[model samples]
Target: MAAILVPSLLEVLVLICLVSTCVSSKPTNKIKSLNVIKELNRKGKYIGLITVTATEENAFFATGAFMPHSKHPFVDLAGRRFFVGKVNAAATTQQLLDHFDLKGIIHFGIAGNVNNSMSIGDVTIPKQFADTGLWDWLNPNATWDPSSYVAELDFDNYNEPNFNGSNNLLGHLGYETVQFFSESGDPNTPQPLLWAQVSEDWLQVAATNLEGIELEQCVNSSLCLPEKPKLVVGLSGSTANMFVDNAAYRDFLYKNFNVSSADMESSAVVMTSLSNGLPVIVIRGLSDLAGRQSGVNAYATFGSLAARNTAKAVVQFINNIYSFSSS
Candidate 1:
């Protein structure tokens, strides 16, 4: 089985909302969310700690006395206001970020990986993301092409001057994309999708502080990971809507891009933050090996464990955030 799990409720909500820009019809859940937004309007937060699933939510905020802000998820932690929601899709992630103003955005969730260096329970802080599987179908006959539709994504010219280069670990990066035939659409000339990067200052803080943090290796006595998990930083990854299960594709992505993780939503989150001129950081735990391992699909076996590691990493990240703020 592929590492891809069924579409999460958040993903489904995003897909449905996209059809009507989140106002197609009066759904019951929509009413509840609207009410929550009204309540949130009275009081929202500064930093948003985003999660994509119940598993991730429980891992981080379960212990806190968090109340739903107008029926949406928002909480106060350590003198900081935080919001946790199932922003599962890229569009949903952007929607949530825009819906609520934030000083910085942090994403903590589970991801797929085939990098042998990382284990199913390991957590990775990706410094940069390379988009894959997203393509612009450029017709050769068309003379006027949208500027967004280009031969390659330009990441070199983009720089973060405000990052305070003292801790920055980013530089000229050459991101890659693939060309292939889509089953639904006509065979078209493919173009590289969007490429964006996370803030180096945020990553450097995470790398320096959480570099050697201990990771979980077992969810329970009955089920355990094959190896101990570790905290990895400054790694790269590929993002795509489709779940990757093929070892060849995983190897190709890792070998080509030197990515340590794979995800469907991180790329979207990165682009959204970049668009808003915010420094977005991603903390993803490996839930599966992307078909590299022959045993049971690890997403089922180690999903919560991965979520725990991500939550732990986020706690550490948040501690660092406070330290930096105070300094």
Candidate 2:
């Protein structure tokens, strides 16, 4: 009886080991198969296309097909052309990686012009996008002003004495510039101090053209002009809570930093791209000056034009890059 029991135990152990091996081996092959399929699917799709938009009115304008499919429209810009599709950041990024397999992204849209000097038609390419909203968590001192925090930190302070000259009073003025400089590094310098310098330079040229200027003379001409657009490469803040939209808030944003623009989505976009080790560029047209109810009216009045100009600038950048690459 003892010998019979021992033999049965050994048999059961062998069966269990066999089952485990088979189960593990099957999953390994299945995973490899799935990965192969995914790679093959990606290879078969489009490559090297771009996505752009304006207001809802002109959102589909570039695509040229009103009521177009969500992510399936193509358009031509001047002679330099690329594909246009609608995609939120995540979906756009994924689709570009998966289907189009794009080399990079060109995010163009209208943004509220916080900089007092920024006119309605001016275009902005931000360098670094701060999630001002995120400060709610990182900033234990909520009493500190949001606008000031952004302005002080966002602009190009390299030439300024101690790099502390505040564009803060400018309202969103330094926002895009600061964002851009932070991401691309100082455009005036040689090293890749930031991530998006090449794109930013392209956008700056486009902005100058859109503004119909031969040169973008700096307010402080003594300071070397930044060759690239100082972009804030992230989503702009969209606050859940209500705060005073009056002069006081604007003053705070303007006085502390020299921020000149604000948006709900830019900071998020920048953060996402940086984290992924992808190049990010932001092209925003001034839609409104930073303020409250009155500011909203101002934004509405010029937002459309700002959006349109921004779109054109993006097109210009694409053309320039294409020309350089083809050359």
Candidate 3:
């Protein structure tokens, strides 16, 4: 009986060991798969070229060299290497940074043209970017108070053409700007909060170098813009998750924010890059007038054209980035 027990115990112990080894090896294999490869780590400093959607990426790729490897997201482009930040905002921006060391970041996408002076397919490189996603809904009886906590949007005052005030309950919305504490700030103590801004060095370089590059006026030969698309610099840009399709809301944003373009992702990229002490710039193509169009919103018709034009501007910006590095 003792001899039989001993052999049985030995067999059980061996099986247990085998099972533990296999279980531990699984995680090890996973970790190994996730580990950054030698090729990615040795690429040196690369520029981050980010796009918010497949259309934008395809348009950007159309302009020049794009070599993508299965191991990483880095793409070789136009005699330079770039870390491509995939779709969406903060998460994608952080992902690019986590994977590769980048010299600077350039975010490009199609946007609703809040400034009516800008036409569809035109591009704008705003100097300042703000995430206007934070908001407070006020009651009809709420007091009109403006403070650091709340910047009221006076939609009632705008008197937007054809706005049916009888059915409008959106007049009480208030905008709140995001504030950040310094990385060194103590959790228990009060610290001054700050807003993020784009890198002036990069902005200056783009402004000086990419002024007159002709933008695509048409998606195809028959669907040309009424006028040739233009590149405008040094305007303010705002971002929010909500798409602005109401003419009254568009007028409010234009009047209150003084922003030329509005999009879903730019401010997130700007904030993330600024927090990391990296230089960044955003190049946006006006896809449609944010709710200002007389007909059904034109974004469905011209979004691709605007994206193509923005890509052209981004390509030109990349070619001239040496000026930024030198500065």
TM-score of each: 0.64, 0.48, 0.76
What is model 1's C-alpha RMSD? 14.4
lDDT of 3 by residue, 1-327 (tens): 000000101010000011111222344444443354224334434455566665676676565433333444443322222333222111112124554455667778889998878888889999887667788877656676767453567546656578764534555677776765433445445433223578887788888888898887877878888899999989998888988888887777777778788888887877777666667888888999989888899988999999888878876776566444534
lDDT of 2: 0.38
Q: Write one digit per residue (lDDT tens) for candidate 1, span 1-327.
A: 000011112121110012111223234455555555444433323344556666776676443323232343433222222343332221122134444434566766889986887778888888888777565543334444344432332222344576554432332222335332323335575434444678888888898899889887879988887678888888887788888777776886776567888888787767666656766788999999998878766788789899888877876676576456446
Measured with C-alpha atoms, the lDDT of residue 75 in candidate 1 is: 30
The residue pairs found clashing in candidate 3 are: none
At residue 143, candidate 1 shows an lDDT of 48
Model 2 lDDT tens row, 1-327: 000000001010000011111222354354554453244334332112222232522532443222222332232211212223322111221222322234344555665555565555566666544444432222222244554433333223323566465443322222222233233444445331122232454344444444442222232446322342233322232211223244555555545444555665555455444434445566676555556445355554555555555545554454454343334
Reference-based lDDT, each prediction: 0.60, 0.38, 0.63
Better by TM-score, candidate 2 or 1:
1
Model 1 TM-score (2 dp): 0.64
Worst 10-residue lDDT window for candidate 1 reads 1-10
Arranged by TM-score with the best first, the candidates are 3, 1, 2
- RMSD (CA, Å), candidate 2 to true, equals 19.9
